[model samples]
Target chain A: MSITGIEIRHLRYFVAVVEQRTFRAAALRLHVSQPPLTRQIQQLEDALGVKLLERSARGAEPTAAGKVFYQEARNLLTLAEQAAERTRLAGDGRLGRLDIGVFGSAVLGPIPRIVQRFRQTHPQVELVLHSLDRIGQIKALRERRLTVGFNRFFTEEPDLSWEVIQTERMVVVLPEAHPLAKRAVLSLAEISSEPLILYPRTPRPGFIDQMMRLFHQRHLTAHVSQEVDDLVTAMGLVASGFGLSLLTDSGRKLHVPGTIQVPLRKADAATVDLCVIWRRGDDSPLLAEFLQEARALRHPPPEDAEPVEKPAPRSAKRKRAPKRR
Target chain B: MSITGIEIRHLRYFVAVVEQRTFRAAALRLHVSQPPLTRQIQQLEDALGVKLLERSARGAEPTAAGKVFYQEARNLLTLAEQAAERTRLAGDGRLGRLDIGVFGSAVLGPIPRIVQRFRQTHPQVELVLHSLDRIGQIKALRERRLTVGFNRFFTEEPDLSWEVIQTERMVVVLPEAHPLAKRAVLSLAEISSEPLILYPRTPRPGFIDQMMRLFHQRHLTAHVSQEVDDLVTAMGLVASGFGLSLLTDSGRKLHVPGTIQVPLRKADAATVDLCVIWRRGDDSPLLAEFLQEARALRHPPPEDAEPVEKPAPRSAKRKRAPKRR
Candidate 1:
C-alpha cells in the first residue's frame, strides 16, 4: 500500500525484466541466472497484488498495474538524483529549486534589479515565479507551495513573517499633456472629477475602490471614461490620453511614453509598499541572503525614508555599490 | 536518438547490474555470463551518450545521469499502463482526464455542483482544477497546460474562444443595517461618499476605479478608509463596518456575516460575466462534453438565456453531464 513496503530492489528487478523482455534474455543481460529475476518479479507481484508482466510466446509484456509502478519508481530515482545535485549546490546557500511567488507590486522599481542580482548570484536554483495576487500568494504559502513572495502588506499570515523592502505613495496617473498633469499634486477629488480608467470587478478590484473612495470622501467623483483590467493597459490608456489612473510609485518605474505620476495629497499613504514575505518557520540560509539583497536595494534610503531595518543580515550578494571615489 | 532506441534487453541488464552491483554476479544470477551483460550496458550507454554503470574493482554503481535516464525509462512504461486503464474506463463517454483552470468567479458559483455531479456520473475521468487568474489561465490554455478556464471575457487570445454562460450586474456593498442599505437602491455617488474597501491594482487596478469615477461625474467622491486586495477582505470590512464595498449578486454569494449587496441607482453597472475559455485549435470531444457540463450547471439554453451555443464533436469528454436531463 505504500513506499515503505516497496523495495528499491524490486524496481531494479522490474527494470531488468522490461529491458530484456525474455526472462531468459534478462537473466543473460544481467549476467545473473533467471531464477532470481523470476523470484524478484514474483515477490513484487505478491506485494502489489498485481501482475506486472505477462510472458507471451513472443516476449514479456507489462501488465496494466506494472506500468504505473514503473513511472513512480522512475520519479523517485529522478528525485534522488536531483537531491544529490542540490547537495552539490548546497554550501553556497542555494537549492536546485527556488519556488518564488511574486506579487505584481514586486516587479516595480528596484525589484527588477533584485531579481537580476539574485539570479546571477544563484544560477543553480531553478527559479519558478507564480505571478499571484495577495490572496493567491497567502493560499499557496499556507499550502507550503511558495518559498517566497514579494508583495504588499504580508497580510498577517499565521505562520508567515514579512519585511517591508520599500514604500511609495500611491500616485495619480495622467497623460503628460492632461490639464491636471500640471497641478503639481492633486487630491482624490481632482482625479475622480476627471476621466478615469480602471479594472472592473472580475478580480483585483480593491485598489480601484480605494482610490475612488479617497475622492468620495472629498465629495468628488471621477468621470470614468474607460474600463480596463490589465495594469499595462490602464497605463497605456493613461499614456494615450484616454483617462487618468492611480497606482503605487514603484509602479511609476514602469512609466509609459506620455504618462506622469503625481503624489496623492491624501489617501492610504502606504499603498505602494512592497514587502518580502517568507514562512516564519523557514530558516534556509538562501532565503536570508535574498532578504539581505532586498535590504541592500534600499541603499542611501530615500528622503524621509524610514529604512525597514531588521539588523541587516549578512549578504553574499555580488559586489555592492563601489565605495566613493 | 529516440525512445524506440530503448530495448527490453537494456532494462533487464540495467536492473541486474543495479541489484547484483557487478556484471559477474548478474551473469551468475541470470545463468548467462558476464560479457553479454557488459555489451548491453555499453550499447545502452552509447545510444544515450551517457555512462550508466561505473565499474572499478569495487563493483558496479550507477552514475547520477544513469539514474535520471533510468527514471525516465520508468515513466514511459507507466504511460503504457495508463493507456490500458483508459481502455477500461473509455465507455459511457467517460475516461482520461479533464484539466480545467477555474477563474476566481467560478470558485463562488455552481461549479462545485457541476463538478460533483459529473464525478458521480463518471468515476473514471479525473477532473483537475487549476486555480488561476485571467492572465495565468490564458497562458496555461495557450501552453496546453490547461484544457479550459472559467472566467469573464475570454478575449485577445486568438488561440482561445469563449461562450458566455452567465451575466449579472454589479451591486454596491454596505453593512446590512447602514442607512444606504435602507434605500431601495443607491447610486455610485451615494456609495462613493463613504470609505471604500477595494482590490489593489496588480497589472491594473481592479475594476472598482472606473465604477467609482462614474460617481465622480456626479461630484461624488469615495472615501477610501483602507485598501484590501481580496473580495473576502473587502466583504469582511463591510461586514465589520470598516467601509462600504461593491460586488455583483453573484459576487455576494460568499456572504460575509454583516454585509449586504444593494442595487445602485446610477447603475454604475459592473458586470459579473462568466465565460468558458478554451484553446480554439483544440477540438477534443471530451472538452465539448465538459463544456456542456459547465453550461448545464447554469441550467443551459432554457430556450431564452442561451448566449451562444456550440456542440461537442464526435469525441466524448472523459466525462460528460447526464444527457442534459
Candidate 2:
C-alpha cells in the first residue's frame, strides 16, 4: 500500500476505538469529542481503503480487514512509550551509556565495583565496556558511541560531555618497611627528589610527568631511576624495594600485599576525577539510567568533587576511526 | 500528553528511522518513497514539538531531541508488537488460554497422551487443563475465558466449533477370566442381556443410551446391574466382576487389575474427540501457530488435504448441543 497517506495517529485512534468499544467510549477514553474519534477512524478507513469497523446497536465489531490492521497498529504504539522514558533521563547529561574506550592500563580496581553496582540497579540498560585511553574515548564519544567513559579530564574538547563518575587519589605504593613509606604522605616537593619508576610517554605525559611538572613548579630537582610501563610491574619493583611510583585508588582492589598505598601531598595530588564523556545529542535510555545510577552511588554530584568542568558540547566532526566495527 | 493526538504509527515510523538511520533509507526499507517518510517525520516532529533529526549531506542524525524520542519509540514498539501477536493468536481461536473443560474419563488414554504431546511442543503457550464435563466445556467456551478443551464427541454443537481429534468405538472392560474377555471382539448382539454396569443419567446421559441406540438398531437387548456416576468407578466395579460395561479409550488407561478392554461393535457406539473450541474471529497468532502445529502432526496435508478448508462458508453449526461448561 502507498505509505504516503498513512499516519501513526490513525492507528492510535483505531486501538482506542476497539478497546473502548463505542465511538463515544473511545472519545471519552481519548479525552476528545466523539466526532474526532469517528473522523480519525474514517480517515484510517479511507487511507487503507477498508472499512475496519462494523457498527451496530450492540457495539462496534472489527471487519476482517480491521482485524488484520489492528495487529500492526498495536505494535507501533508500544515502541512509542519506550522512547519517552529515555527523553525524561537526558536533562542533566548524567543519564545514558558511557562507551569508554580503554587504552593501556591493565589492572582494574574499585571503579569496576562501582560500575557493577550501578548495573545491578539498572539492569535494563547495557554498558559497552571497552578499553581506550583518553584520546580514543574522546573520539568515540564525539561519534556518539559513549555517553560516559574514561578520558583525559583536562582535555578542552568543547562539543563532548563529561561528568566524573568517580575520583581516584594519586598514591605511592611502597613496601611497608621502605624508606619512602616511613615518610608518610610525602609532598610532591619531597617525592620529586627520589628515584622514580615511569610509564611510556607516547600516549601523552604519564602521571609521573604531571608529578614532575608540579616538582618543576616548586623548583625541586627530581631524580631519574628505572622506568617501567606496566602498573603491576611498577608495583612489583616497589615490592622489591627498587623504586616507588604513583597510582590511584580507583583500582584499590588491585592492591598487592607487600605494597602499601599512602596519599600524596602534591599540590595537584590527592585526587582526579574520571570524567565520563558523551556526545551532546547522544540519547540512550540505558545510558541515561546508568548516569542516574552513577550519580546515586557517588552521592554528591560530580560538580561537588575536585573535578571542575562542564560537559563538552556536540562536535562538528564525524568520527570515522575504523573503530565502529 | 493527549493520547488522541498521537497514534502508534508515529512511534513506529520514529523507531524505524532511529533504528534504520536515514529518512530516505528508512523510507526505502519500509517500501515507501522518501517524500512520505519525510512528511510523516515532519508531522511527528510537529506533534511532539521536538526536532528529532539532524540531517546533513552524508546522512541524517538524531538531534538531542531525537535521541530522547528514540528511547520511548523503541519501548512503545516492543509492547505494540507483543499486543499484535496476541491479537493474531486470539482471532485464530487457537491463541488464547484454554481451560479445556474435560471429564476425568477423557484424560485417561489417548486424550492425556495427546495433551502431553501438545504441551511439550508448545511450552510457552499456556493450556490449563480443567476436569470439566460435557456441560462445563460448552459453558466455558461461551464465557470466553477458556478456549479449546477435550469433551465427549456425542452430539453436534452450533454455537461452538469442534472436531473429533480422535475417535474410538465402544470397548467393554471386563474381568480377565470373564467369558466375554476370551472373545476377540464382542458385539451388543452377542453380549445381549449380560450384566451391564455404567454411569447413571445425571450430569451426563448414560453410556447405555448410546449403546442401547446401537442395540435397538441391531434389534438386541442388554441388561444392567449397577450404576455409577464416573467411568473410573464403574471400571473398578467391572474389574471386580460386579458387572460388565463399555467405555471409550479414555476410560481404559487405568488398566485396573483383572480387567481387559475388548472392542464392542454396534450401530451408535460410544466415541470421544479431544475437541478444541475458541471464539470465532479470535485472531491470535499463537493460536494459529498451535493449530498449524497440531494440524501438521495430525493431518500431514496428505500431499493433498482438501486445499486446507478456508474458513468454511456459513461456519459449521454444532448439530449436537455444544457441551455446556
Candidate 3:
C-alpha cells in the first residue's frame, strides 16, 4: 500500500506505541491485543517507506521522524475537536457576527435596550451597528450586508418582511417660553397653523414624509419654516424659537435645554410604528435571538403575573392602510 | 446521537449537500443514494440541535449556522490531509531536525563535507551544531539533546557507540624560517628535544592526553614550552618562533602566516581516528544518513570501476585496545 492508504487509525496506533513506550501497553490502553497493534505499526512503516520506531527488550522508542510526526498528529486531533465545538456554538446562535442597520430616532430609545438584552444573553455574538437611512437600509439588507434593519416605516416588498415592534404616539416639541408648553396636551390643529421645523430634508419617504402624511390626514397644510437633516438639528431650531417640531415617543429621551416636549391630544395624535425588516426567508439564529429580545422588551409581562400567560405576537402585521407613509 | 458522535463521514456528507445544493446531486457526487444522504444530513442537524438547511422546490440552501459549519469543516478536512502528508515525509527522513555536537579540529575538515552532503540529500532537516568536547557530547546524547557527535579519540562508554570515519597521520608545524622547514618528512626523534606548544589546557583526558600517549609509545620525551586553550593559540605561538606543534590532517587548512607544516615519516607517524558517537541503541534515520555520507566521502568509489563490487562495512568495531585515549 502507498502513503495514501495510511488512515487515522494508523496514526492512532503509532502515537499510542510511542506514548505508551510499548506495543503491549498501547494495546492494553486501546482495549486490543498486542499482535494487531504490532502489525498495524509495521504496515504504517512499510506504507511510508521509513522505520519510525526501534523495538528492544526494554521498550519501543520513536526515531527522529516519529517524534516529529507525533507532534503534528496531536495538533490535528485537537483541531478536529475545536471544529466541532465552534460549529455547535454557531448553530446555537451563541457565536458569530450580526450586522444590524439602525436609523433616525430608533437609536435614542427601545433599540438600545433591545441590543443590551441580546448582548447579555448571547455575549459571544458580535453586534455591528450601521447608521443608514430607510432606502440605504433596504439596499444593504438586500445586498446581505445587514441581517436586520430598524426604521419608522417600511414599504412592503415581495422578498422582504416587516414586523412592527411597537407604536409610538407623536409628541410636539415647543420652546420652553411658548404658551403651548404650559398645556399638558395639545391638538395638531392648534399647532398646524404655526410655523414648523421638519426633518430630514433628503431620503424621501422617510420620517419627514410620515410627518407630512399626519398633517394631510387632517386636511391641513403645514406652515413650513425650516427643513433639516436630523432630529438633533430640528431640536436645535425648536430651542432657538424657530418653530415647533414633532417626534415619536422615543424622542422624549432627547432633552434640549430650551425646549419642552408635550404629548399631542390622543384623538389627533398620529401613531408612528417602529418596525424591523429582513429578507423574508432568513432563519439566522442570531437574527432570531435579536428579534426575540426586541419583541420581549416591546411587550413586557406584568410584574406580578406569569410570563407564560402573555404570549408575544409572532408577527404583528398591521392592515395596509392606504400605504400611509 | 450527541455532538461527540459526529464523525468525519457526517461532515463529508453535509458539506457535499451544501456545495451541491441538493441531496440528489450530492449523492451523485459522493456515489451514494439520495435517501441515505438526506437521512445523514437530518442526523447531523439533530445531533447539533440546529436546523442547518431549508429544503424547498428549488433546492437546498444552508442556513446561517450551516454556512459557518461549512467553512470549519472544509478547514478540518484540509488539515487532516496535511497531517498525513507531513507524517509520510518525516518517516522518509526528508523532514525534521538533527542536532550534532562538534569540537576541536574535526570542524576544519571532513565534518563540513559530510554536513554539506547530508544537507544536499535531506535539505529539510535542520542541522544544529553544538561546540562540545567528548564528555559533553556523551552527556548531551544521554539527555537526547544530541543526535550525533564528531570528535577524535573517543573513550568507550557502556551506553554509547563510536564509529571511526577516517584516520589521519600527524603533521608537525614549525616557524617558516626554521632549519626543519627544508625536509619533506620528519621523524619524532628529530624534534624530541625541541620546545613544543600544547593545546586545550582544560577538558582533560582529551587531545592533549592523546598527544602525550603518542610520545610515550615512541619512547620519546616532549620538551614542554607553553600551554594554550585552543588550536589557534597554539598555532599563533608556533608562527611567532616560540616553539612547534602537531596537528591532524585537517589542521593543514589553518594558514598561520609564519608557520610551515611537514608530514611525519610513515613509520613514526601516529594516526588519530576521527569518529562519530551516539546513544548505543539510537536507530535514528538522520544519524544513519549522516554516517553513510561520511563513510562514502572517506572511501570514494574508484574511477572506471563497478561501484557495486565494493560494499561498505556496516559496523567496523575494532577490538577494545587497552582503552586508548
Give the winner by TM-score: 3
Worst 10-residue lDDT window, candidate 2 chain A: A311-320
Ranking of all predicted structures according to lDDT, beginning with the best and ending with the worst: 3, 1, 2
CA lDDT of B63 in candidate 2? 67
lDDT, residue A249, candidate 2: 67
Candidate 3 lDDT, tens digit per residue, B1-325?
2234466677788889999998899999989999988878877776666667878898899876788888877776677666656655565556788899999666687889888888999888899999888888989999999988988868778888777777889899999988998899999888888888988887888777888788889899888788889899999999999999988888888879999999999998688888888778666656666766766876754344332112222221212235548
**Candidate 1 residue lDDT tens string, B219-240:** 7777777766677878887888
**TM-score-best of 1 and 3:** 3
Interface RMSD of 2: 10.8
As a whole number from 0 to 100, the lDDT of residue B91 in candidate 3 is 58
Tens-digit lDDT track of model 2 for A1-325: 2333456667777988888778888888778898878878876665554456878887787854467667667656554444443443332233444454545562364346556876676454446677777777777666666556654354666676566666667777767777777766677766676777766444675565665665677788677587666677777887887777777665555787788887777565556555556665444434455555655556556554652343333222223245536
Give fnat of each prediction, in order. 0.00, 0.19, 0.34
**Lowest summed-lDDT stretch of 10 residues in model 3 chain A?**
A309-318
Q: What is the C-alpha local distance difference test score of each model? A: 0.65, 0.62, 0.79
lDDT of 3 by residue, A1-325 (tens): 2234565567677888999999999999878899999888877766565567877899899866677778866675666566666666676677899999998567777899888888889898999999988889899999999999998778878878787777889899999999889999998889999889998887887777788888899998888788898889999999999989988888898989999999999998688988888877776767767777777875663345332112222221212234437
Candidates sorted by DockQ, best first: 3, 2, 1
Off by over 4 Å in 2: A1-7, A28-56, A61-79, A88-94, A97-325, B1-42, B71-82, B108-110, B113-125, B135-168, B172-190, B200-204, B209-221, B232-236, B249-325
